[model samples]
Target: MSIPSKEFTGRHMLMTTVAFFTVVIGVNVTMALYASSSWSGLVVENTYVASQEFNRKAAEAKTMAASGVVGKLSFLHGAIHYDIRNRDGSPAAVDEVAANFKRPVGDHEDFHVAFAKVSEGRFEATHRLTSGDWIVEIVSRRDGKVVMHEADRIDTGGSGQ
Candidate 1:
């Protein structure tokens, strides 16, 4: 005996079209929800105020750069360290070293740490970071004026160092 094959009909086409659109719409909704729940991408709270101070901030940054002061930031044994140096590779004089740690996507997990002097141009903080990406802004001040400001992106691997 021979077996008869099933025939393709309008009902099958309608079901196929509905399934395809359902899958597409489901994926799009999921992606949109994730995107909206993640980062807000806000650099500053008030853009107009920031714009007003832009020229003065730019001038200050230029002066800081011209001062030939640079800083190296590192993490070791769960401690945060910063080394400040002058153009001649000598230790730069800084009274206080403060670090602001922020996540790239969110304000949660953001923190501030003050560093103590370990030696000339070397400062260390006893805060441990969780293993992830971080944006660290190191600011060195002398006589209540910022002498060096550096921003860097760091990835702490599974070690959290």
Candidate 2:
């Protein structure tokens, strides 16, 4: 009875290396494609203009803070409630209040809703939002100028409030 010997060759090593690298390269390509297709990576249309605008907004926010104008915001029962007040806790009145809701991951679900003053310095809007992580931006405008601005992140998971 003759026993056949299985020999290890350079060809066999080369094939094994190629197979391993092929899978690694394939996975990397797949991940790259998915990341590129997920988002545009452009938060603003123009970077220079956005930077200038951001600086201006920062100045405005600083001026507002110095003037003792501030605000508090909350979300509940399919409504956005906000209270604008001064450093002394006196209610501050504004011409109009605008709220912008944006999902953290994508801009597809971004929406703007205007809040009406329910009471003195207290604004509320009935805009129903889905359960997820949301970036809430509230701006109180007076005479076509931003008087008070605030931004926050909220996760509606358990409180149900």
Candidate 3:
């Protein structure tokens, strides 16, 4: 005697469709939660306030760029180093140097490092950043006024060196 097989029916079809949609919807919800929790997507807290200062900040940036002050940054031995020069290739005279390190898409690893003068036009900060991509903002100040402001993107290789 042969065992009989059950025939496929509309109830089976309906259950299959429901199961497929449930899995799809569940995966989409999980992905959405992960994306939302990962990054806040906030560039500036107040757009209106930022807009009000846009022109002045732009003018200052233009002036800073026109001054031809250049900064070279490097990571060595788990330390941050910055070298600054003027248009004439001589050391730029600034009283203080500070750096803001930020992740490309998140703020969890963001930090501020105050650099000390190691030598003429040279500043050093003993901060070991994790090996990854970073956005660096270097600000040099003279007599309580910002003299040079530079932004650069850098990758700390696998060794974080």
Tell me the whole-model lDDT of each prediction, alpha carbons only.
Answer: 0.88, 0.83, 0.89
Report the error of model 3 at residue 126, Å.
Answer: 0.5
The lowest-lDDT stretch of 10 consecutive residues in candidate 1 is: 36-45
**Model 1 lDDT per residue over 28-51, tens place:** 999999987886444777999999
What is the lDDT, from 0 to 100, of the residue 99 in candidate 2?
86
Off by over 4 Å in 2: 1-42, 158-161
Which stretches of model 3 miss by more than 4 angstroms? 1-42
Model number with the top lDDT: 3
TM per candidate comes to 0.71, 0.68, 0.71
Inter-residue clash pairs, candidate 2: none
